[model samples]
Each structure stands twice: as structure tokens, then as C-alpha cells.
Target: MLIPAVAARLDPGWASRVAAARRKLWLALFHPRTVLEAFRGETPGFRPHRPFWGMRGGVSAVFVERLLTLLTALPSVRINPVGRLRHMASGPRGTVLLDFAAPPGGAPQRLSLPAATCALGLGAEELFRAAGVDYAPQRLSVAFGWAEVAEADLRHCPFSLLLAAPGAPALRVSAGPVAEGGRRVMALEFGHVPEGLPHPGAAEARRALEETGLLREGAPMRLLGVTSLPCLQVPSFDNRRAFQAALAAFHARGPEGWAGQLLCGAGRLGFDSMNEQILTGLRIGEP
Candidate 1:
């Protein structure tokens, strides 16, 4: 029998928020359980909190970087690291034609290949719009850093202690220790940092850590590095409509035409979901 459970949970106006929450919960819970069931041959069952949230804050650049490295290693994959896509259109024999803007002091290039063979790495609202599709996406900026910490202390640190004061620039600190370059490190991630505010340096980070007792007062610690992701999309009604239009356009082209839409570019908040998206594409894109 057909069940309307999903429809029942969604209400007008608030549908997007509810839907987003559902997705967040599913990704937080079911995804990990599925992974455990697959790799360990056991189910993790219900969890009080998303295990990775405390430790990693749901961000893992290393996973995506590794996946990209593997793809680049594949001889069949053609990567254009510097070239910019100028135009795209459907061509004969189920192929898609792509035009690349000439790099400085370089000639423009064009390539045609099976539509299913190509995948866009990032959102392409302008490209879709050029092709007569209405698409818009909103994005925000965020930053993260790694700080060397004693693994024992990180393990004992509670999630509540990692949170910032109400008006603090630091969004939340990750108590979980992650390995980087053979060194164990804790992550301090920030969201909505003031535009002109300088990044917290080693001293500032040390103070923050000391305040939480994760780092001993006057203890020597190193700030591994800091980086920012500028184009994290913010979900909204307009963006959803635009994304659907773009999807419909590809669907009209062919069954596999939509396969190129990468999960990392699906307007999700965090880039960590890229790994999940890759897994999903692999699972469903094939027969």
C-alpha cells in the first residue's frame, strides 16, 4: 500500500525547514549506521548524538581530497585544473559539447563527449541560466583550523565545553582528535566570523583552549593551519526552485544526464557531505 507519511510531515511555508531538518537527521543517523553495517557487518543501533558531530563537527576535507586524488589518477578522467567552462550544449549522438574560455596567453578549447561522461564539480547556476534555465544559489563563508592537543584531553572534553559564548566569534570547538600529517589535532571551526576580524592566531587559540581546560595554562601548542570555504550555499525557496528547474532540464536531455550533478554542489551547507554524495552517486548511478 502507498503511504503518505512523508507528505503528512510536510506543511506549507514551513515545508523547506522541515525537509531540511529531516535530511539533517537522516544524514546524521542513518548514514553512519549504514556505513557500520557495511564495513563491520553490524548495526550501531540508536545513538544519543551523531558520533562524528562532537569530534569532527561534520566536516572532513581529507575524505573529499582523497576521492579527488583517486579520480585524477584515473587515466580516463580528463581534469581541467585551470580552464574555465564558457559554454555547454547538447550535440549529436547523445554527446554534450563544452567550450572553455582561453586561459591568459592560451587558445580557447572545445570538447564533445557522452553526456554521462561529464560531471560538474561545482554549482553552475550561470551556465544553466545561459542555457535558458532559471537557477540561483545563495552561499555563506566559514572557516576551520587545526590545533595540536593531547589526545587524552580531547577524548575527555565534553561537547558542552567546546561551545562558544553567545556572542563569541568561534562557532564551536571539536573535542575529537583528528590525525593530520602524523600529528594529532583538534579542530576549531567558525561560522559568521566578522568580515574584517583577523583570524585567531596561536596565542588566541591557546587562550580559548585554556579557558575550556582542553589545554593547560601556558602549555605549548601549535596551530596546525587555518582555511576558509567561501561558497557554502544557504538554503531558500528561490534556490530550491532554481535547482529543480536545472534538474528538469538535464532530465529532458537523457536518463543519465542528471548524473553529473555532484552532491558537494547540491547546495548543502557543509562540504563534508561530499563524501556521502559521492557514495550515493556510485550506488544509484549504476544499474
Candidate 2:
């Protein structure tokens, strides 16, 4: 199914987060039940609330819920929550998900995600579909992994290896290459982020992006897909081998239960620096 790009400010407080309704645009396009089931699974005895417009609303609710339920209950996926998520997106930023950060000089190896957790994560299509009319491609802000690496690093970095074939996009802490794509520039990430790259703050890079007109002024940063980017594809490794390698790495040291499952990323790849042409007056101006 097609998805949308969504930029939202997450409320950390449990109550506050729960109280906030799903994006209105999404609710308008699809049935609310689909949203609920994706998270809540089977909500037994879920009766439809009769809106002012009576029967029709009720029927609509039922239809939506059933469809969602089928989607949820069927043999769906056994993704490594984070890896699978990053694997499915279509953006450089969305692909570069940050997992737990390594302490200074700490040797880091693999990533792990649990089975149950708030699925704030999604794929590229879902992000776009969620955007609908609400998508304002300004500042792409996502969960920023645990530590906020400079956007400069993210842009040049890859999520995993020199080449992430399937699992995740390669993001390096240091500089990487940006390829020329027809009329667009495709940034290719490879290896780990260089330690010299700015840590907590990347305002300088942010400004540079704005100056270049890649990121606009008031847009809410969006987290495109799961943040825990894993190395699923070894350019030379066969698909089966890559899949096995990714799975084994996680299964051995997976995060405990729900705490591990939430994988997502918000870092962005500036508009291929094609403002004058592609982005020229696309107008949804800043947030």
C-alpha cells in the first residue's frame, strides 16, 4: 500500500502522547480502524461510535476495522522491527536510522529490536501516504536515533556498510559521496560516521542546508522509517546470506521485549540540491 510523508512533534509524556489524535489528514483518507488495528491488533468488542451522521459512519467504521484486522491477523511479517523497517523505505534520511549510540571508543557491532513496542516507525511509502496534504518537506526531523549527529554527517553517511543493499542505507559519520542522478543528486552513504563530526549539535550544517535551500524554514522534522538501521545487504553477499547475517546478529543480542522494537529515523537528505528546478516553488512552505 502507498504511504505518506508525515512531520510531527512527538509528545514524550505518556498521557500527552496518547491523547494526541492521529494525523487528521490520514484519518480523512482511510478508515480510523486501520490505524487502530496496526497498533492495537485485535480490539475485541470494538463497537463503532456513531458520529452525528449515524448509520453510515458506523458502517464505515466496521468496514475499516475488518480490513485492518485482516491485515493485522494474517501472516504478516517477522521483521527485526528496526531492520525490516529501514529496509523498506525510499529516502536517504529515512534509510539512515540511528540505533543506540556507542560510548566514546566503545566497540560497537550489531543492532537489536524487540517484538513489541510503540511502532512509531514505518516505511517510505507509509510516510508519503501519511503526508497527504499535510506534508511540508521542510526540516526532516525524526527520532534522531539516541544522539543528534550533525546533519552533515547524516547526509554523507550511510546507515550500515559501505553499501547497504537491503537491510538499511549506509550512513557514515564522516563524509561520503553524492552521485548525480539524471536531474537529481543521489547521496551514497558508506561506513561509520567519523568521530570528528559534530556530536550533540549540527546547527552549522543545518544552516548550511538552509542556505543551500535544501531544507526550508518552518517545517517540522520528519522521521521517515525505523531508526535502527542494520546492515542487511553486503554488496557482494547473496540475499540469503545477508538476510541470515542480519537476523543472527539481532537474535543473539536482541533488545528485551517491547523496548527493542521501536526503530525509526528522521535525519534527511536535502532536496538533491535541485531547488531551482525540482523544488522550485513547490510551495507547502515551512511548517
Local accuracy of candidate 2 as per-residue lDDT tens digits, 3-98? 121111111121222123223111123355665674587643445754343233223455556655776776763322222222211123222223
RMSD of each: 9.2, 23.9
Number of residue pairs clashing in candidate 2, backbone atoms closer than 3 angstroms, sequence gap of 3 or more or interchain: 38
Residue-level lDDT tens digits of model 1 in 1-287: 01122221121122454355334211122354564564587755656645544213334665567668998999997666435666777777777777777887777888776776565554456455435565565544566777887554442455434342443435456654345543356677654334576766676567667766666677557888877665445455565666666766745653334345444453333333555567656765688
- Give the Cα-based TM-score of candidate 1 against the true structure: 0.56
Error of 1 at 28 (Å): 7.5
Give Cα distance to truth, residue 155, candidate 1, Å.
9.1
The best candidate in terms of lDDT? 1
Model 1 C-alpha RMSD vs. true structure (Å) is 9.2
